[model samples]
Target: PVAAASIGQVYKAVLRADASPTGERMTVAVKCQRPNILETVTLDLLTIRGVVDFFCTVPGEGNKKLRQDAQGLLAVLDLAATRFLEELDYLQEAANGARFEREMNAVPVMRDVVKVPSVLLDYSSRYVITQEWVEGVKLTDLEGDPKYANEEGAALRADVVRKLLNAYMVQFLETGFLHADPHPGNFLIQPDGRLCIMDYGMMTEILPDQRLAFVEYMAHLTAGQYSKTLDDLVTLGFVSEELAKDPAKREVVGPVLAQTLSALYAEGGGLDKKVEILDQQAQSRIGEIGDKLEELSKEYPITLPPYFILILRAFGTLEGLGLSTNSDFAILEECFPYIARRLLSDDSPRMRSALRTFIYGGGDRLNVAKVEDLTRGFGSFTNAMEAERKVAVTGEGSLAVRSSATPSGQLDAATKELLELMFAPEGNYVQELIIEEAVRAVDSLSRDALVQVWQRLPGAPPGAL
Candidate 1:
C-alpha cells in the first residue's frame, strides 16, 4: 500500500480473519508509524519550544539587559521542552485516544459530523492507530471543480461548514471535548454528503464554565458589541485583564474586533439571503482577518486556551475548505444562526443566564426602539465612511463632482497609526517611536510615495478592515 501521510502511512486492509465476528469483509485503515518517528517528534518539539521562546522573549526594546533576560527565558523554555519530550510516550498518546473516544461518545453532535473509527485496540499498539476505513473523496479534491463551484456546490459546502461548526460548538460548549485537528485532509465528504472526520490523536477539552464564557464572547462579537466583546474575551481568558485595560491596546483591538464582527454579521446576512456576492466577500475578508489575527497573537502575547485554539483552527480549516469548494458559500452565516439558536435554547443554562443579564440591563425596555434603530442605522455610518474613504483614496468622484475638486482626506490618528502598523515590515518595529516616526515620514513623502505606502499596507477596506 502507498503511504498516505508523512508521520504515519495509511493502508487499506481487510480485517484479520480471526477478528471478524460474522465472517464479513470489511476494509480498515491501518496507520503505521513512519521511520524514526520518535526522532521526528523530538525535533518538532524542539522547534516548537524554540518558537515559543522567541515569541515570549525577543527584545522589543534596546537593552543588553533585556537580551540577557531573554537568554534566561530561553533556558527555562529548554528545560520545559526537555521535560515535555521526556513525557512524550506512546502510552500518553494511547491515553489521549481513549479520552477522545470517550468524549466523542458523550457528545450528540459528534454522532452527526464526526466518525470515530472503530478501533482494533487488541491489534493496535502505541504509535499505530488501526480504525475502520471510510470511503470518501477528500474535501480538497473538490476545489476548483466546476461541478462543486455552482449553487448546489455552495449549498453543500455551506451545509458541511455548518455541521462542522456545530460539532465544534457542541464539543467546546456542551461537552468541552473537541477535535484539535480539522484540516481538510482530515475530513472526507461522502457521496451522501455526510462529513467523516478522522484522526483523534490530537484533542482538547474545556471546562463547562470556560465553554460558557466562550459562547458569551462569540455572541458579543457577532452582535458588534466591541467593548463587551473585549470584556468577554478577558472574562473568557482569551485576553489578559492587563491587555484589556491598556488604553492603546484596547483602542487597537476594539476596532479590529468590530470589523471582525461586521464581517461575521455580513456573512450571516449573506447566508440568510443566499447572496453569493456578500458571502464570497465575507469569506475573503475573514481570511484576511485571520492573517491579521495571527500577527496580533504575536504582538499581544495572548495565550489562547488549548480548547479555543482547537476550535479556531478547525473553523479556519473548514472556512478554507468551503472556499475551495464554493467561493461564495457563507459558512459563518450558516453557522451563526445555528450557534445562536443553540445558545438561546432553553436547554442551555448559560444562554438563559445571558438572557437574564440582557433583560435586567434594560434590553427588554428598549427592545422595540433598539430594533428600529438597528434596522434603520445598522451599517449606515460605517458604510458611508467607507465609501468616502474609498473616494478620497482612489480620487474617484461620483456624478455631481467637479473635476478639480479635491476630497479632503480625513482619517482618525488612531486609524492612521493602525494602518502604519499594518504596513510596517514584519519584525521591523524597533520601538514605539519608530512606528510613529515611520508613519510621519511616509506622510511627509510625495503623494505617489504615500500611495505606494498605502498600497503596501496589509489590511482590508474600512468596512472589512
Candidate 2:
C-alpha cells in the first residue's frame, strides 16, 4: 500500500501509456475507499447521538440547559460527519486538490515553493482517486534523516516550515479556503526541497468577514491585548455574542479565556513543552476554570462554532510539526510576518485601524522600538531603502548601489514583494503615520528649545519657564 487512512488505503501504480492523458506511462497513487465505511460511520454517529440523547432525556431541571448545550455539540458533530462522508467521494477530493493548486499558484511566493499533485479525474470515481505520485518523505522524518542532520539541512527545514506556515495564512486570511487536515503525514518534503501538501479530504471555508476577524484576532492576541482579543473571539464565533456583551459575563469569561491562551502563547517553550504545560495547568488552575465555565454556561449559553474546531485542529497539528522541526518553534512568532503583511496590504477600514493600533501606543505615540523589531527580520528592508535612496541621488542602477559602510546584502524576493505593497498608492496610510510621528517629534523639540531659551533669559524668575 502506498498509504493508509481511516476510510481508505492507497496503492501505487503506473498508468498505461495508451490510457494516460500525457500519452506516456505515469506513476500514480490510487486511493480506494474501505468497504462498508459509509455504513460503519453512520452507525458510529448514531451510537454517539443515542448516548447524548439518553442524557438529554434524564429528568432534572438542570438537564434542560445541558440538553441545549448537547444539542449544539450534536449539531457540530453532524457537520463534521457530513464533511467526513464527503471524503468518501474521490471526485470531490479531486476538485479540492485542483482548487488548492489554483489558489496556491495565485500567490507569487507560493507558486514555486509549494507543490500539489495533479488529480487524474478521468480515472477517478466516488470510491477511487488516481493522483500523480509524489516522491518524498513525511515532513517530520526530515529531522531524523541523515541527509538533513547538518547545518544546511537545518536551514532547509526552517525555510520549508516558514513557507508552509505562510501558505496556511494565505489560505485562511486571503483565500478563505483552508486545507483543514494538517497532520504530519499530510505534508511531504520532496528531495528537491519543495513541500507537497496532500489529503484534501477535510476542508473548511471561512467567510470574508470571518477571515478579517481572524486576522484582527491574531493581531490583538500577539499584541497581548487580552480584552480586545476576547472581543475578537466573539466576532470570530468562538464565544457567544450575548455573553461577550454582558459586562458581568465578560468579567468571568475574559480572565479565564486570557489565562487559557496565555498558556498557549507563553514564552520560553516550543509547542511540545507548551502542551505539557497546558496539561499541568489543566489539572490545577485551568481545571478549576473549566469547572467554572461549565456552571456559567448553564445560564450564559457559551458555544463553539464548527469552523473553530477545524481551525484549531489545523493550526494545532501545524504547531506540533513546527515543534518537531525546530525546538524553538512558536506559532505566533512564525505567523507574525504573514499577519503583518496582511495588515500592511489590506485597505479596509478595520485593517487600517488594526495597523495603527499595532504600531502606535496610547496617546497616539509611535512605537518605534516595536516597528523596528517587526521589520528587522525583513531581509530586503534595508537593502531596498538604501538602493532606492542611492538611485534617487546619483541616478544610477539600483542593483549596482552598494556601500562599504554596510554589509553586502542580496535582495529578498518576499520582502521585495511586501515592499511594493507598502509603497503602493493604497499604502499612503503608512506614510501618514510616519509623517504624524515626525511632526510630533519636531513640535516636541521646538517646545523644549523655547523652554531652554526662556529659562536662560536674564533675571528670569526661578522655574518660571
Worst 10 residues of 1 by lDDT: 397-406
**lDDT of candidate 1 over 183-293, digit per residue (tens):** 767777654444566766666667777777766765555455567778887877668788788886676677656665565544533344434543554477555655555
TM-score of 1: 0.60
Q: Give the TM-score of candidate 2.
A: 0.82
How much is 454 displaced in model 1, in angstroms? 68
Off by over 4 Å in 1: 21-25, 47-102, 108-113, 144-150, 242-307, 325-332, 346-349, 357-362, 366-465
- Which residue pairs come into collision in candidate 2? none
Task: Give the best candidate by lDDT.
Answer: 2
Model 1 accuracy (lDDT, Cα)? 0.56
Please give the distance, in angstroms, between residue 25's alpha carbon in candidate 1 and its true position after superposition.
4.3
Clashing pairs in 1: 268-333
